[model samples]
Target: MTLLLTPVSLADRVEVITPGGNASLTPPAASTEPSDAAVETFPRTTAATGSGGTTYSPAEMDTQPGLQTMHFGAASLACKVASSTTDLVVINQSPEPLPAGTRIKWQLKKEGTRGFFAIIGELGGGESLVADDVLDGQAGKDDICIARVI
Candidate 1:
């Protein structure tokens, strides 16, 4: 016995064939564009003005210590600190939901003014992390460690 097969193309549908006969066609569902809220950007200050007539410009600030990019499951994250303080900030830019129990770890360097310090904190219900004294001193190059629990 001999078998022969013929291929057919439909305008916008997909078809399959079994030995019995041609299978029913079902077009794929259309995809929707992601919402603007799904996308997020890191927050950065061009310059900071504090009490005692102190001003720190981004250009003048030293390079952030242990700067690294991280992904928490489906969410994207970036970590950085000011040149002057122990305060560290992490930004989440993932489209999927990020619950309050996620955790992230990264090496940090405390430089500039405040001595190198290690920071560990947790993310709150509103998708923000709370810290005690993460970014607290002169801005320079110091290695630090930062971990966030989301």
Candidate 2:
């Protein structure tokens, strides 16, 4: 099967689970102030004002066939599937490296399960992660993919 690398904005779907709870990771609109739910989720993230302002904010990530890429703050997680095995490609884009063992998970929701089940998945440790197997034949047409970085 062929998969197109279409960029989709996962504004409300992406989340980061922290010790406090699951916090929404969607970056706020530039024109408007960030809502309370749009707060930073990673603890090691830079909170100080920099040349560009607050350095940490969740941003939407993209995915393609056999691979999905997601981000939170300065961390990036890429989920790839090949030969029936899924592997997570983690890269720390931030200056400070993310601590090892940060929980990262990628899950493809089962088709027609109303978001209650996952058909295929893999786990890894990182600073951020996302899951959306667009051409994996396991996700529904209108499925909402959730990438969780704990």
Candidate 2 residue-wise lDDT, 1-150, digit = tens: 998898886665545678978644566666664455545556556566646654665666543223343344654434333222222223333444444444444444543221211323333334333323334444433343333344
Q: Model 1, 1-150: lDDT tens per residue? A: 999988985674435667888643443344584332333445564455555544444455435445554455555555556443555555554455455444455445444232232224443333544333655444444454444423
Best-fitting candidate, measured by TM-score? 1
Best by lDDT: 1
Against the unseen true structure, what C-alpha lDDT does each candidate score?
Answer: 0.47, 0.41
Residue 11's lDDT within candidate 1 is: 78
Worst 10 contiguous positions by lDDT, candidate 1? 112-121
Q: Candidate 2 overall Cα lDDT vs. reference?
A: 0.41
